[model samples]
Target: MNEWLIGLPEDQAVFVARVAIAFVVCLGAVIGSFLNVCIYRIPIGQSIGKPRSHCPSCGRMIPWYLNVPVLSWLILRGRCANCKAPISVRYPIIETLTAMLFLMVFQMWGNPAIFGLVRLQEPLLIPVYWAFAATIVVNSAIDIDHGILLDRFSLGAMPIALALSGFFPGMHGESVWTQGLIDSAVGLVGGFAGLWIIGLIGSLVFRKEAMGFGDVKWMGLFGALFGWQACVFILICASLLGAVAGLVLLLSRKAALCSAIPFGPYLGASALIWLFWGPRLLDWYVSLIVPAAL
Candidate 1:
């Protein structure tokens, strides 16, 4: 075994790492499957946890074997067992995507070193990041389908993000607790206020409700987790991406100029990018533009 892997305390056994990774992957897949329920139900004002997983066509409760995430869909040939109604491909897709994302998080953060270090163990930041990503995935899908982000998701996400920010070590080796708290406070305020201001301006100019409250709340949640600087990056990146998407849709005759496009997905995408690569991307951009501007 490599020194890094073997150096972990006996209590934090190497076998535990494997188990942890497997648990996270399975949990993510299961959560993703549940998220599909949220996506379909939240839009239509249905309770997500109630009535159980059932076919919309025949209202038949899904059996345990048939509800086994990705495998079940394939086994049933993507049709409801009772009604033979063709199931939407979304279930397997969400499950697969979540499983992949969970695996990625495990690969990134499951180092024995992390578990062995007492300081690193306290705040549990990795799971927080996972939750953030999962929230983004769920909210983005909901927004795309309903043209609105649900309050349930956004409201639920913000405090978790804040808690994660407070727990995670600060950037540049600063005091983890203090800096994380400061960052979380600043990020929450900046994210909410900044977006709110823009939304006000947009509403005034357009003479209607411009930015959805959901977008603003989502940004605030992103800010709380990622800090103010990352929130700014998220805002800029999401806007640019949204504009590009809008332009593409327009050119393709898919969306009219006056049509409303939900901004939550772009924000979610930008936040994810920032989560993994914010500083590196910022540095690259600065290096590229600074010399030219100078």
Candidate 2:
């Protein structure tokens, strides 16, 4: 696959790659628009599909023209065309974020295999990673808004993750189904227990609930997908992120010392970092330290 691209003239290859990326961006934004629907409707128990997009203020059904992802929001000036109600800027932001994330995934997995001169690897991971990215966005947004992680997204994803690992053993850096399943199961148990113990210690130290059970389950889902090393990386990275965020909040006087902050979003962010650069970052750090030790 990549050989064809490599054989093309450099100018033509660049044009072809740009065209492919542009298409991916458009598709991502469209999917993101649907994700916005999922984020809004899931919490309220509304059917995301049956009811067409509508203005919440005036109950006006949005036409196709008014529903074209980020562009429509800009054209309408962040207001509903019918009632002139102020629309949240979050719509465009979500669309943009999804578009960018999708592009990154394409660059990471699709570029070498389909667009560039590099060797082709697993092309199937492109769609898998996209789905993973969307899941993170939806669940993170819901957690930010509701302060609760839905079991449907967290615990519900565990079996699916395990199944994927078994089917695509390459996900776990293995070629055999049994080894992949074993690694996934180990990570799952490690993720759950690791967070549970940390939560216990935090409660003891803070004399209050310091972690939500939802976060534990969320970590388990990631573990099932990525394996034990990723679980450890996510745990460390998320804790640092949470600590930094908590410090900023405290300094700004926006929250009390004991106020509860949702942790799922941090976990989601950490999962993404792991997906993109965790292994490389870990290797870099190890190299620095190992040389010094020796």
Q: CA lDDT of each candidate?
A: 0.78, 0.88
lDDT of 1: 0.78
Residue-level lDDT tens digits of model 2 in 126-220? 89889889999999999888888889987888998898898988788899999999999998999999999999999999999889999999999
RMSD of each: 4.3, 2.2
lDDT of 1 by residue, 69-89 (tens): 999899899999999999999
lDDT of 1 at 278: 81
Clashes of each: 0, 0
Off by over 4 Å in 2: 113-121, 256-260
Q: Predicted candidate 2: what Cα RMSD to the true structure? A: 2.2
TM-score of structure candidate 2:
0.93
